[model samples]
Target: MSHIKDVTGGTPIVLESLWKTYANFVAVSGIDLSVGAGRFCTVLGPSGSGKTTTLMMIAGFVAPTRGRILVSGRDIAALPPQKRNLGVVFQNYALFPHLTVFDNVAFPLIMRRVPQAEIAQRVERMLETVELAGLGGRYPRELSGGQQQRVALARALVFEPRVLLMDEPLGALDKKLRSSLQIELKALQRRLDVTVIYVTHDQEEALTMADQIVVMQGGRIEQNGTPEDLYDRPATAFVAGFMGDTNLVRGVVMAADKDGTLRIDHPTGRRIIARASGFQAGDHVAASLRPECLSIESPDGPEEPENAWDGRIAAVTYLGDAIRYHVAVGENRPTLAETLVVKAARRGTEHRRFSEGDAVRVRWSRSDARVLPPTRADARILPPMQAGGH
Candidate 1:
């Protein structure tokens, strides 16, 4: 994608103490955020997490019940949707079926009363930018899902609004197509240098396309950080599990030191040492261990490893690029420890050969274990033996 200079540059957005409440139910609660000029930020969560409602408020489609929405230092909380001069792309692609792609893309320009000749020129340029230059004569019904989505994007961007808001714009496409569009969309955003605030429930999409990710739960912000920060160091158990797959071991602080380290005793009697600041003995905690952070070896391996557990291989799943092994550990109250072996990291034929009933040792470094605040999601703890594996 080629970089296209436009008038949308250099405009930042700020939401100060923003909130929305209808009767006794609250949709969004006290959100404060700032989107830097030309940055891509994503609000991510499960259903009813208020991500979409927050986006609508930013687009002026839903008025804030309290607080301010500032655009480039000017408050636009009272402005109407059209008066805010922001672009919005919805999941449904909101295109006019009766009009040709060209006219549909030019609708915003027409509403703004730009000269007819300029509108035609700008629409044509946008069509070319979105790789739909030759398909402008076709109606929305005649276009493919991807093409129609491109048309909607072109329409929202053709006017060069200061900020572009996308609410699950790629959610309707197939996985392969959605993945392809994600790359193209990120490239297009950088090319245009437009501030984009995206809302989606897909963690993969958020991780792939966002410069910053704000995780929300129960109509409130759970955590906000860069992709790496959120993935490697989640603040809460919900975030640790929600952001990606991980094994959460619930325990209580058996010992604590002033140097930000603590020894946790699991309910199954397994002890784990982890790093957690500002916690004393007897504090409940959960350790989030990524699958890749663990390694498996022979049960009688000579080397002494930290956080080692002996288990019989219960199940193995072969993902395209990696192999996942679910091992059952502990005697009375067992827990499943999931370990991953990357195809590239496989040592030899022996590493690739493993039977379901073979005994193995699962171990991980102490530093890999991230101690976090306990959550309701972790309250239920491990699944029963009959059900097995998380």
Candidate 2:
């Protein structure tokens, strides 16, 4: 595997006000992004969210309806695909059926008219890099799915292209294989010192592999930041719900303390405290809290915390690693809370376990709650769950 220091220098790729539209439908709407040289940047979004279209435009496969694509300040919008010095690995391998692994990897070098000896040396080295050295003589059909994908990867890297573009290259593989290849591909990209623009709809894959993530929604960028930044402080309601599971509590602000505390009145008649950085009293707000930030405690556990709310256990689901508990307040929708299975089991034995009708208290820290604008100030609250229904 190549070390990060081995490939840290190169020219950055910039997308300036890029846009793509088909007839009346806009696919990518004025996206501006700059990818640092030798960094792994992932474009993440759901299907039909313009991630693929943006990638295609960058690869020169689809010409943009408007805007500019630059490489190290050079305008390459009109450049042919082959002339742009890029390596592309599509979802479908795109390997030549008649060519052996060696020939497949050597194709790029051959096109450049490299000497036969040099081509063999470069192809052999690439094969070793992808851990497919001995299988170079085998046809694509003879190799396993993972091995074939590795050959495709080696082919893309053998020619030492200036930039690499991968469009869901692991989308066709099984989960286990996909995870293994993601680590391998990230390591390889670092070793090769090549700029990479990766596109995927899988949030886990993007969070795990990317140095920076550009989250897209409805043909526009919702947020762009490091994984921790987006996870800890989501900038919008869509980002909070889309990135991970979040509990949204709709309420009206009752008071804003000078010490940065916000008192809010929930529709359920419960009061909660959140940060009051950008909000004022009498304003409507929505608070987003992660399930992991909440916990179910006994009614008699202790004095209520600053942000604790008393509720009844509505439902409990036992996932393999954790137990998910749904707690219902007076009239608000039940909020989900996840706890480690071991902890939940111990609590069940030592304390009054949260049965179908058990009373409990959900608590979190004020710092963990994120307050933002409400979805709709005039939206009506849905009916609360019945005794045994969550």
Highest TM-score against the true fold, candidate: 1
Candidate 1 per-residue C-alpha lDDT over 1-390 given as tens digits, one digit per residue, 9 for 90 to 100: 112233455678888777787765778877778778888999888898788889988887887777678888777877888888888998874799899999999999999999999998999989987778889899999998878988998999898876899998877778987887788778878887888999887999999999999998877788888999899989899899998888888889989988987988876677788887978899988888888888877888574644887777777777655678777776644445323221223445445556687888778888999999886441211212243211
lDDT of every predicted structure (CA atoms) = 0.80, 0.77
Model 2 / residue 312 / CA error / Å: 2.5
**Which pairs clash in model 1?**
none
State in Å the error of residue 340, model 1: 9.8
- Give model 2's clash tally: 0
**Cα displacement (Å) at residue 3, model 2:** 27
